[model samples]
Every structure is written in C-alpha cells, then in structure tokens.
Target: MTRQGQGFVRHIELDSRVGTDRYPFSLPVVTHLAGMGRLDLDPGVTFLVGDNGSGKSTLVEALATAAGFNAEGGSRSFRFASRSSESDLGDHLTLCWNRRPRTGFFLRAESFYNVATEIERLDEGSGELLRAYGGRSLHERSHGQSFLDLVYHRFGPNGLYMLDEPEAALSVQGCLAMMVRFRELLRQGCQFVVATHSPILLAMPGARILQIETGGTIEQVEYEQAEPVALTRAFVNHPERFLDRMFADDA
Candidate 1:
C-alpha cells in the first residue's frame, strides 16, 4: 500500500464495463517494459535511460502528458502547487488504475533557457527565482549552478518530478551536490523519473532504472548494472589506460 515515507501509488482495477478508450491509447496499454518489449517500474524513483534517439525522452514526455500535464510543462506543470487533483484532466496517455500524482514537475535540462524566461515572467510578481543568485538573471550563472538553484528552490515534497539529461552542464561535484539534495527530497516522499547519462546521478542507490535501447523497449535494472554506469566507471577508473589505447600510437 505504502512504502514508509513514500506515498502510495495505489493499484487500479479496471472494470470490464469501462471501455478501453477510457485509457489514453487504443493499442494495448504499454504498462510494463517487458510487455512493451523492456523494464517494469515501481512507484519510487524510475530512471529512464538510453543513448540519444533511444526514445527515452519521448517516453517520459508521454508519461507526463498522459497524466494531464502539458508536453513542455516545466517545474510547475499546470502552475506551481495550484491544484492537488489532476484526475479530471482525462487520459492523455494510458496509465494503470489509481494513477494520480499529488504534485508534478518536469525539468528539461536542455530547455532550461525556457525555464529562465518563464521565471523572468514571474519576476514581475515575485523575485524568488531571480534572487536565487543574488539578483543576477539565470543567464548570469553558469549552466550547472543555475540548474542546481532551480531544483533547490522549485522542488517540493510528495511530488513526481521528471528530469531530462540533467548532466548537460553539471560538473561531477555539482552532480554529487544535486544527489544530496535529491536524497533529502526523496526522504520527504518525492518521486523522481530522471533521464540522465551522468554516472554520478545514476548512482542514486535504490532508485529504479529503466533502460531503453535502440529498437528496444524500456527495461528495469539495478543502477550499478546500467550500461552507461558501467561504461563511465570503466572510463573514469582507468582514463589514461583507455585514452592511451583509444588514441594510442596512431602517430
């Protein structure tokens, strides 16, 4: 029913009387990665991973959209903490029964420029976002620092948050800092569905990982077992050796 500090993602029992169309799709529900042809996810932290063009972003967008969220909604999907119930929005994507997220945020790492603009619009009313960096616009801050500020100031507990390629600007140490913040939020029952390639971010223990390969469906695996994690570890653990071989004696 519930996972300690985590909220309950109750199971939905579809009634035979309810038409399939009540769901988001005509194609049978792609509820599980294995069913869709990869990984199943628990209600906790679900990481969707794959190479670029592997459809990872597409899947997260669909999930957010299906949950009555706009495709490009940022940290505040349908406004900041405006409404707690989104069930009335209807099916944009098929979901299991009892699917309702108390709060939701979508963080598109590359589209952070848009986030800054959106915040500027809000600055007319409240200067919270601008104040994040002592009155400097997010533009004034480096990419990674700005992202950290957003998560630090925008994120709340008991919410479902999605992140795409958050590693774009974060240095290794910054990523670790983000992880610390993430752990604090997770303890408060916040759930994360992140799409990232950074080995540091992927190392969040106990988070569920979904890997989507080329022509492959999403599948759940341990974080340590992820291809990106493995590859990054190998590279970092022995960079000189690997680099020497990679660019070796080509001279």
Candidate 2:
C-alpha cells in the first residue's frame, strides 16, 4: 500500500528578496538557489550531497529555522539562537515545531564551538557540572567525547533530527556506532536529514539522496551513484593508484 504524507515540509517558497542581511550574520553562500522559487524537500531520510560551499549548509539552516527548531539546540542556525528577532518569519517558523519534533537531530560539524557555549549556558545555574558530562565539565571533555554523548543521549524515537556534516569529529568506530543508532531510530520511525561527506553515513540503505550542486539546483540521485560516494569509494579501494594519478597530474 502507498504511504500518506507525513506533514514534513515537502515544499518551501524561497524569495531572493528575503535577504540574510536582515539576519545580521550571513552564512557563506557559494551557490544561489533564489531563482528556484519553490523547492521540494523529501519526507524521509534526506542526504544533502554537495561539495563544500555549495550552500547546502545555508539552505539547511534556513529550512531548519523555518521549521521552528531552536537555532542553538542542534536544529536551528547557531547565529539565530544568539540573536533575538521580532521578525514574523522567525516567529511563525518556530510555531511549526511547537508541537514537538517528529523524530530527528541536526548535527553541525563546524558549530561545535557554539555547542560548547550552549552547554556552558546550561551549566551557569548548576554548580560544578563536570560530573554531568561524563565526570568532566562539558568544556573539559574532548570534542569527540562530547559529540558521542550528544548522539547517545539526545537521540530518541520519533524525533525529527537534522545533522550537518556529522562526520567531522567521529572516528571509524564512532561512525559505525552512529550507523547502528540510525538504524535503531529508523526502526522507530525517526527521520534524519543529514549533510555529510562520510561514506559510512551515506551507506544507510533506502535514504533519499539529494544533491545540491554549486549551481544552486537540487537533484535526487542514488547514494552509490553520487559523485561524493563514488569518488570516496574509488580512493578507498585503490588509494595507491589514486595517489599516483594525483602526483602524476602534478608532475
């Protein structure tokens, strides 16, 4: 039987006139999709596949904010959480998720600094928080440790989580552990939207892969057929040959 719509944000209307300058802090936008008008987002696991600076992060940030997640809480833009806005868009977008997330988490690879700061803010009133985060202050724990803890404790069934480049701090084993968690969450009807370069994460079966090209257009493709996955696979399978070709080209 066919499935029904799950109330995920299937479509979004983006206007170029709605500039980020009003947001005060502007994210790096290497690709411009302002002309796309209305773009469709898939309801299930979505892989925003693209090269660095392709504006995947920017688009995801905007969409997450539009979906009403707390910017600093892993689901919204980090900058938005630090600043206050009276704008209707921000207010209205937040209302969408007021009911509670369906199931998911947003992981930003480069925003660990903000995450650290957020933990500190949470510890302000609580004295001696070192014991709370694995017997060390959130700041005292290593970056990887903190990240692993976030995944372990924060991930739950029926939550809509968005992750941005989650592989930045994880080791091979950590990634594998994450894959296990992902499967568990998926089984519980949790949906994930991840922007990542990690082949392991991309290998999650049945994920809907969407490539956001540097040109700002988004396209759906297979994980194995993706440029990132293919290039990564080739290098891993034949690193010596790949390196030789690279050096040969330099020669």
Candidate 3:
C-alpha cells in the first residue's frame, strides 16, 4: 500500500516538442515517458524495477539530473564529472515540486567510485571535511561499509535522495540495514527515488514499486507482483526447478 506522505518532487513530465529520433529519445523507456506525459512518484519511496536494459536506471538518472544533482552522483554541490554519457532526457523533463529541499543527494552505484574520489579530493586530507562522511574516506571502507556510512552520516532529515541500483554493493544484511535506515529517514521526513532489482530492498514497507515493463511501459505494481520479488521468490522456492528448465533442451 502506498501511503500519502510529504515529498519533494511529486511527478515528472516530458516536454512534447522534443525530437523523437535521437539516442535517448529512441530508448523505449524514454518513448513511454514521452507518450505517457507524466510519471508520479511516491511521496516516500518509489522503486523502479525491470530486467536489464529496460531503462529504469536511465529514468532515475534523468530525474536526478533534472532535480539539480550532479549527473555522475553526489549532492547538488558536487560538480565532478568522471565522464559525460548522460542522456538529454533530463533537459526536457519538467519536475513538479511540492517544495524545495534544503539538502539532497544523487547516489549512483555504477559511478560511486568517482564520487568517492571527488569526496577525497574535496576533503583534501582534512579530517574536518570528512566529518559529514562518517569521519573517514569512503575509499578506505569496504563498498558495503561506504554505502552504510552514506546513509547514516550524509543522509539526514527532510532530504531528497535518488539512488540507482544501490544494492550493487550491498549484501543481504546490508540491504536489511538500509531498509531500517530508510524507515528512520522516512520518520525524519525524507523522500527517496530508487532503481533496484533487489527484492529485499523492494520490501520496504509502504514503498511503491513502479515496474518498467516490456516496451517501456511503467506500471505501479503490488510488491508481490513486482518482477524482482516474484522471480526471486520462485527461484528461491525451487532453484533446481528453474535450473533444470535452463539446462533442458529447447523444444
């Protein structure tokens, strides 16, 4: 069930005038968003899930960019660019804001190494600058530890956060910890937009799972119906049943 709660940006709509025969514009997800005209976000957490190459991450990245975050990842203040491969979809997006947030961050799992490097550069070996990041270099910690510290330290009350595939660095235990932290942050009036395939992360209470279907249609699905949850449940319940089918000869 989706609970109506305080959120920052309420929804996103694509501009109608944008050209259709471009790189990102040609992506099915982009076409769907363009055709649909608008995508509503859950006031608390919105989970985008789909099979690989489905463009869930692309949409999340565009949302982050349109919301004033660095394309690579980090807080709005971060201006570092490891590379410039972002789609122009963000440029045409119109974000409907409930209110402006004092603080926010865009955390992209794929490029967090660059963000960490930037953090270290900004800190310049000063322990004072590292205080906001658990008082140590994110590079010094294990991948999972660094992510944990990000939530516990850098994230705070009334903040807006966009994360793409955060589960990339987490173990099952880490996912659970992040869920607990998410609850705490929600109580503190935070909002989250995340793209993930982790059924565990999708199980966070009251989160709205928006699954990007084939051909780029985005639909709001129940937790049980979410692709990750349904598939993972099936595989765990009977791994051999699935493996056998895979090994069996095609008809």
Candidate 4:
C-alpha cells in the first residue's frame, strides 16, 4: 500500500510573477498559491474539499489543463472545445512530474456532455473509439452510468485522473462504487486528484484530504476534521436540531 514514488505528478508550483488582476488569480485560493510557492501532492489519492467558490474546482481544472488534458474535459488526444470559459491560470502553473502517465483523463462534471459529444464525433465511421468507452456513446447512458462506464472501462492501469465534482451526477450508491473503483485503480498504480463535496467520497481510506479554508489556506486534515464529513455527520445525527435552528426566528 506504500505509494512512495508511484505518482505521476509530484507537486505543482505557481509562478510568483503571475498577474493577480484576473478572474482566477483574484480568487483567494489562487492568491494563496501565488504565495505558497508549491503544493505537494500525495502519491495515491488527493481530495480537495471546500465550500463553493473556495477554488477547489478551479484548481483541479487548472491542474488538468497544465498536465495537458483538454480544458473541456477529456483525454489528452481530445481537442474539441465547445466554449472557452477556462481561466489562463494553467499557463502559469507548473507540474513537477516523477514519471509521465501512459494514459490519463480529465473529467469535469459540468462539461462532460461536451466530452461525450467529442467522443461520438471521434467514433464516426468506426466504433473503435467508442469501444474504448464501454462500447457505447456516453450520451446513450444515464449521467451516473456514463461516469461509471468511464471509470470501469476507459480508465486503465498506470493512469492519472483528475476529477472535479464527480459526485454532482452520482447517487450515494454510485459514490460507493466509485470509491471501490478508485481503490482498485490505486492498487494498479493509478493516481487521482479530485475536488468533491460528497462526504462518502471524502472517506476513501488513506486518501489525503486537503481542506481549503475561506481565507485561501489549504491544510491537510483527517477524515474526522474534513468539513464535509463533520457537517454531514452533525446534520445526519440531529436533523431536528439543525432544522429547528434554521426556523428559530419563525418559532
């Protein structure tokens, strides 16, 4: 289970001189990175957890782009762009690689439809490309099913995967399934960088959880300390209490 020296990317660094007046650079998390110099990555799985706009997704997207995956979400070979909403932060980000991945994927939940469309286009004339993705167009499957298909069929050993809010389309059961797949892939020498809000996904054993604070600080935290886990536990344990607090004014 020792993952030392097994990851493709060792760390990521930001250029100190990168401009700070832009959309992403102005973001608190990005500003933190500008001063932090470098962020070291775990060799197995690294989970970025935070509230909305904390810059977890933005960081994951920038990492994927800097690592050569398409900004719209797909493999390195995928070159189609539906639109250009991605920030230019990737250009200023630098990855330190221990070894290059033989295969890889960037999966952004918001833009997966475009990735599927690109897959269908590539599968034109022949089904070779489609076969690699569960032998069916991702569009033909339900959202969660398609995500699972990609994890089970397209992803392989010794690959690098970056995911942003993968739980957006998945149910609780699906999240458990993804966790199982992630463990299997990790044992097969794959590495993952994920930005997620799901408490279930955050419980992956041995995964490094980096919690992004509101002030733009990223700190490694235990499963018990992760905000998603702690908050979910509180809500689940005493729903009435939380509900009462929310409606206290009315009472």
Winner on lDDT (2 vs 4): 4
Which wins on lDDT, candidate 1 or candidate 3?
Answer: 3
The TM-score of candidate 1 is 0.74
Order of all candidates by TM-score, from best down to worst?
4, 3, 2, 1
Candidate 2 per-residue lDDT, tens place, 182-216, comes to 77766665666788887788888777788876545
Residue pairs that clash (backbone atoms under 3 angstroms), model 1: 12-97, 33-38, 38-218, 38-219, 39-218, 39-219, 39-220, 66-93
Worst 10 residues of 3 by lDDT: 1-10
Predictions: Cα RMSD each: 6.7, 5.1, 1.9, 1.3
List model 4 lDDT by residue over 189-220, tens digit each. 99999999999998888889999998999999
- The weakest ten consecutive residues by lDDT in model 1 span 10-19
Candidate 1 whole-model C-alpha lDDT, 0 to 1: 0.63
- Compared with the true structure, the alpha-carbon lDDT of candidate 3 equals 0.89
lDDT of 1 at 202: 80
| lDDT (C-alpha, whole model) for all candidates | 0.63, 0.63, 0.89, 0.92
Predicted candidate 3 versus true structure: per-residue lDDT over 1-251, tens digit per residue: 33334899999999866757877888887888888888999889999999999987788889999999999999999998979898878999999999987798999999999998999999888877688989999999999999999998999888999999988999999999999888988887888999999999998888889988998888999999999999999999999999889989864
Best by TM-score: 4
Ranking 1 against 3 by TM-score, winner: 3
Candidate 4 RMSD to the correct structure? 1.3
TM-score each candidate: 0.74, 0.74, 0.96, 0.97
Query: Where is the poorest 10-residue window by lDDT in model 2?
Result: 90-99
